[model samples]
Target: MTILAELPTPAPTRAAAPVARPSFAARIRRAAPPYLYLAPALVLLVVWTYRPLAQAVRLSFHTWNLLPTSPITEVGLANYERLLSTPDLGASVWRTVLMVLGILPFSLVIPVVVGLVAARVRGRIYQAMIFAPMLVAPVAAAAVWQWLLDPGAGAVNRVLGVRANWLHDTDLALLTIIVVTGWHIVGFAVLVVSAGLSGINPDYADAAAMDGASRGRITRWITLPLLSPTMAFLVLMTVLLSAQWTFPLIDTLTQGGPSDATTNIYYLLWDYGFHSYDAGLGAAAGVIFFVGFGLIAVGVVALSDRVSHHDD
Candidate 1:
């Protein structure tokens, strides 16, 4: 008798189960994980930025020092009206405007040109040397200028063989302030413009060159247009933060002085807030300052977007 092996039977298969489809809300919830991760930052932004803005708006409407003992007077727009009529207020606003204009061209045009030219520089040495001034603190830069413009110990007068007082002269004081501020921020501007230039597709410039376009022609038609967004952002930032960026130098070096020639709205607010112990006045000034700059910045960026067309 021979032993025989039994053949195995095939297992029966079951019907395929339906694929589970996510509902609209469930999909949204799943997609929301990234935003949920951002919740801490969102909360911080609201706390630091919006909370003060909201409080400032309410405080601006009333004449309150925001001190414990001080009473809040409901003088709707009185503080604003008072801010408008103050004599030095006009000067502060005007000086701020002038600084914006002075800084805009210096920060926007000069650095961009320098950065472009530096891109073609032979070595890293030259590039670093040119960008060095921007690494210095604004206060330190101003102090250096103060020494240079000393009219006594400063080498500027000695080199030029002139005894003219730089700080004593009110007419020159504001201009000097601009120069000091510009030197401090020049490196940053150069860095931003250089990054923008580096990001530009060299292919466009190459194509333009192939078409017999001059260096200047390619720069004017191709390079500059693409750089508009970066320029626009810088302009907006300089406009919105004109005082904060430059005022510290003025505060530390000049104290807005010689005769208030360099005094900006920030200086005015600071004087009132700290020196005069009048937080109500300072708060009013702060509100006025914020609103004016905010409006101007909004207008500039809005206008820029209308005129600009960026390539992807």
Candidate 2:
């Protein structure tokens, strides 16, 4: 057996398969078109948005009266330092804070409840009636409210049997802004919240009801958790937009006065850049406003996403 089997054992050798490498040109060809397609928008963003931003930043470091012929003096951080030192700045900031607080209760919270109730209504007629406010232009809406709040002859005064100047007194002036401004902006929140409510699964409600959950219990324990994302989004928006919202009304009705009580950041920036012609300080304030607001908006979004996911 040994002699036959061991006669000759020949070893077989195999060549290694060639490595399959993709060509660099082929890879680049596949990736290049997407960037090429994006180039136009990329160029446009830099030209239109970023270019202005860059100019604003550059101007913020210099003292200019917004006159083209004015000498540009680099005062380092003096403009920012001055804004911080300004006595009225904190009050103006606080007023902005007040607006945020005052607006959110009526704007986001009340409308959410209304939207939920409206959703339970059988027909679109009631829904449309409630939502009609959203269709009105902000300026037009402000005008309508201005007429309604006219202290001498307006509907509110007539109904309440009280004759008081609504927009003249500093205390009442900001209040009027809150009410009037709420009218136009609240509608948007209502619509968004309503849409969010409608998207929630009805099965959750049914399940809660089956377990003998009261309406309040269902809403508190079941519905609200599910509605968290929408509510968060609405609140976030309400916070960010609260400052700039009174612009048209404040401009038209009060002009940031009865004693600067309504002079928010928007009004301040306008006053600085346009009214006072201090473009450098205004530009710095713009940067501050943008940065401050950007952080808040980011925080709102992040915290919302976190809370919503945690609920899930």
Number of the top lDDT candidate = 2
Q: How high is the CA lDDT of each candidate model?
A: 0.79, 0.80
Clash counts per candidate, in order, are 0, 0
Q: Candidate 1 local accuracy as lDDT?
A: 0.79
Model 1: CA > 4 A from native: 1-49, 64-70
* Stretches > 4 Å off in candidate 2: 1-32, 309-312
- In the range 1-312, model 2's lDDT, one tens digit per residue, is 111113565765646634886588976886698799999999999999989888888888889987789799998998888888986567778888888888997777887788768767775776576667767766787778778888877998999999888888888988888887787677677777777787788888998899898999988887788888777877787788887777877888888898897888888877887888888888888888888998987787778768872233
Report the lDDT tens digits of candidate 1 across residue range 61-149. Answer: 77765478978887787777877898989998899989989888778989788877877775567657767987787777778888999
| Pairs of colliding residues, candidate 1 | none
| Worst 10-residue lDDT window, candidate 2 | 1-10
lDDT, residue 183, model 1: 74
Poorest 10 consecutive residues by lDDT, candidate 1: 1-10
